[model samples]
Target: MPLDTEFSVTVMGLGYIGLPTAAVIARTGAMVTGVDVTPAVVETINSGRVHIEEVDLDGLVSGVVARGNLKASLTVAAADVFVIAVPTPFTDAHQPDITFVLDAARAVARVLKTGDTVILESTSPVGTTEKVRDLIAELRPDLTMPGRNRPGEQADIAIAYCPERVLPGRILVELIDNDRVIGGITPRCARKALAFYRRFVRGACVTTTARAAEMTKLTENAFRDVNIAFANELSLVADTLGVDVWEVIRLANRHPRVNILSPGPGVGGHCIAVDPWFLVAADPANTPLIRTAREVNDGKTDHVIARATAMVEAQPPGQPVACLGLAFKANIDDFRESPALKVAQALAERFGPRIHIVEPYATTLPPAIAATGAVLTDIDTALETCAAMVVLVDHDIFRSVPLDERRGKTVLDTRGLWPDQA
Candidate 1:
């Protein structure tokens, strides 16, 4: 390996994944230029402000800017390394939408120089890196690529697939801490990519072919989806039997080898809920567990919605119901694929103008949430005004709220993080 004084790194897309990775690279003493199509995000980063809601991101961005190792741009500039962390959302038919990744590849291709390494960090279909390499080669035919037999006949660019396995709120810690899997189109590709991550990655870089790397990421999440679906399915069965699923899980997991995941309203996130579908969509016959898990999770939102509606129906018609928390999970302000949001929306729609929502972490809601006729209010106001309480997320604020304080209200705890004392 070669020791260089400065590595010019360009990160495409300044969303949750890109921003944190760019900031971390800069923190490791690399010159990182972050590129985003959004002018507001670009401006915010340049001013040392963070638009995302991750913990410690603002400070990280501030530190990176203060050291002059990080900057934001709307266009890509020449760099020794380029990290493509763009979005890979699905289409209406639930197929892999690689438009953003392709655009990012093309963007980097324009400024790509000899000896530059491009790492595709997005969760994608198999052969995605090869597709990116082909896209780059198409744009810059002047560049020579490494032939299978002759490693010496290498191209101006090298490509690898290194998918991120970080949670949204824990991106900063996980980026360096989690064991990474690096898959290169060639053996040389894998080594170069591993070298880049070694600067900050405390975890080991497991090498493999690019297809395996891509499928490994997909399989990791699919495994989670399958396990959670099992728990969810068991929860439904336990619900029918009038048995506490959490208690059942506790007893079952007491055995020497059982490791059961806790059941929630549903699985929700940019990754777990979405990525499994990519595999099932690709090879439906081979991925029955993945398909079933997705079905179980997707079906959970409706189950929660029904439960909330039933709880509301049991109350008087004019009763004001308080919905505690709006984010997908606990303590954070992410609403993407949140079953809590669906339950709240269902209740608000069913109750119509009678839903008093108290999401202490989030003051204003997006348009979709605002359309549900929910009155966003302070926790105290929501508790004081509403007759029924529905605890969605186990946020610290909701945990801090005493059950004794909620005397007259009917509390339906979805997370079961709190006790319901009548």
Candidate 2:
């Protein structure tokens, strides 16, 4: 199919994934309208400024908005393609919540017309695309949807699921270069979405059933979570045995068949930390390993907090401690489910006004951390003033600190970033 440069796209939710996706699509000469519930986000994008951080996204969004190819809005608009890129956060009990997906579907239903293609790019549980189809069918009975029509009959609109499989810091590059799994309620739906993606994607768009696509995303994250859990569990064992976990991994990895991922304070971020729970929640009895992996990763955070607390307590009274990095991962501003943030907050609450934070990405500490009287200071000031240092996230700047600068400080290196002590 020939690419449609004149296509109009409305992408719901202008957060991390959605905004970058909208900007990328607009670069392909498509008229893209990014929709968000927050008025501030919409206004920010319309002014050619982005609220979220991503590589090259600001320049791309600026060029697209300046060229009049992309705009942001507070409500849905009629378009040939509607992409639902909202969040699918879990409930308090860790059950996969599809309320945001369904709500976005309802909003799209208002402006959905014949021949429009609706794609759910949000990471969702199995049958979520079908739920979206059902909700749209309920709202607009006048039009036919995929799965509701006969085998030989075509629906008035197409619906498909294509989850974003990009890393945080590399979203713009991966969005265009990574292979995509395009699944639909029907084969035609898959083909339609594949064609849309081919307009911009340099990757192979493989097609499959909607459920498989959903499960594929979950499986990808769960696999990483499991491997990470192994490394984290090994870290605990190494600690108990009085050995360096990083040194052990380094020597073991010399064998071609053995490769171990670096352990952190814990698994964080919206995907790996949260997606695996959906699978376990779907079938609790058959997923003991998955459940255990989640437990081990979560437990690692508590262990880090306890260790940091012990180090802080060992210091004399009035000796301030510095917590480095708050983002879940390094070099990004996203702090969702970040273990570093949790550890920092815990330390601040336990030792009021004695906790200083060194997060280069954030200008000010979040309310929760600020309320604990923890001051956000520069790395230089933190290293000079604080008596103890806890390296939570291995950000590049923190990793490059000279060994001499770390002298005389009680360092709790959760990420194994610093050199081995003499």
Candidate 3:
């Protein structure tokens, strides 16, 4: 299908995934309106400035906004297509919560027309897309809906699930080039969404049932969580045997058939750390491996906290201990489910003002850490003043520090970033 420049797209939740998707769709000449609840976010994007950080996203959003193709608003309006990209975060019991998804669906329902297509791009549990279809049907009984009506019959509107499959740092490129799985309540619904995505995506858009699409995303993240757990378990075993985990992994990976992932303090981010639990929660009896992986990953954070605190306790009384990097992974400011932040918080709670944090991405310490009297400082200041150091995140700046500069400092390198202790 050729690009439809006249199509109007309204994307809910203009955060990590939504903003980028809206910007890229606008780049294809579609008039895109990004819907976000935050007033600051709405004002920032309308002025061609971004509130969040993503590579090349600011330029893309600015370009699209300047061309009058993209805008941000606090309310949903009439559009040809509606994309719900809100956060489907879990509840206190780790059960998959679809409150945000349903809220977006209700908002979309208010302005839904006969020919509009609604796509759920948020990562959700199985059957969420069908739930969306049901919600819309209840909101607007005049128009027929797909999946609820006869199989061969076409409905007034199309609804589908198309989960995002992109890394945080490379979302802009992946949004255009990555293959997407478009699954709908019915075959016709799938075709309609495929047509919309084909307008901007260079990669293949495969069609399937809505249930399969939701499960596919969960499987992808669960697979990663399981593999990372193996590496993290190995790191624990290596420490017990007095062997360097990084060196062991390097030698073990020399075998052509064997490929092992590097272990960190723990698996973080919204996906790997949280998605596996959805599987376990859905089928507690059958998902033993998934449950174990989640436990191991969660345990790794506790292990890091124990080790870092032990090092801090061994130091002289009142000596500051530097905790480096609070972001979930390297080179990103996202701290969702970050093990580094947990470890830093534990250290601050244990030693009060003696915990010095060096997160290059954050301008100020989080209020909780700040309330504990932790000081957020630069890498040089941390190295010069702190008696002990814990490398929680392997950021580029932390890796570039010379080995000699770390001499005479009590260091617990959880990432194994500084293998050579000079």
- In angstroms, how far off is 47's CA in candidate 2? 0.5
Pick out the ten consecutive residues of candidate 2 with the lowest summed lDDT: 1-10
- Model 3 error, position 270 (Å): 0.7
Provide the lowest-lDDT 10-residue window in model 3.
1-10
Tens digits of per-residue lDDT for model 3, 1-422: 44466889999999989999999999888899999999999999999999878999999999999999999999998999999999988888989999999999999999998999999999999989989989989999987999777766669999999999999889999999999999988888999999999888999999999999999999999999999999999999999999999999999999999999999999899888888888888899999999999999999999999888889889988999999999999988899999999999999988889999999889989888999999999999998998789999999999999988998878899888899864
| Steric clash pairs (candidate 2) | none
TM-score of decoy 2: 0.98
**TM-score list, all predictions:** 0.95, 0.98, 0.98
In terms of lDDT, model 1 sits at 0.85
Candidate 1 structure quality by residue, lDDT tens digits, 1-422? 34343788999989988999999989878889999999999999999998888989999999989889999999998899999999898877778889999999999999877888999999998888999998888888877653333545765567899999998778899998999999988878888999899988999899988999999999999899899899888888988898888789989999999999988888887788789888987898988878888999889778878878888888887878888888888877788778888788877777767888888678786566688676888888887777888888888887887877787778777676764455
In model 2, the runs with Cα more than 4 Å from the true position are 1-5
lDDT of 2 by residue, 215-312 (tens): 99999999999999999999999999999999999999999999999999999999999999999989999999999999999999999999999999
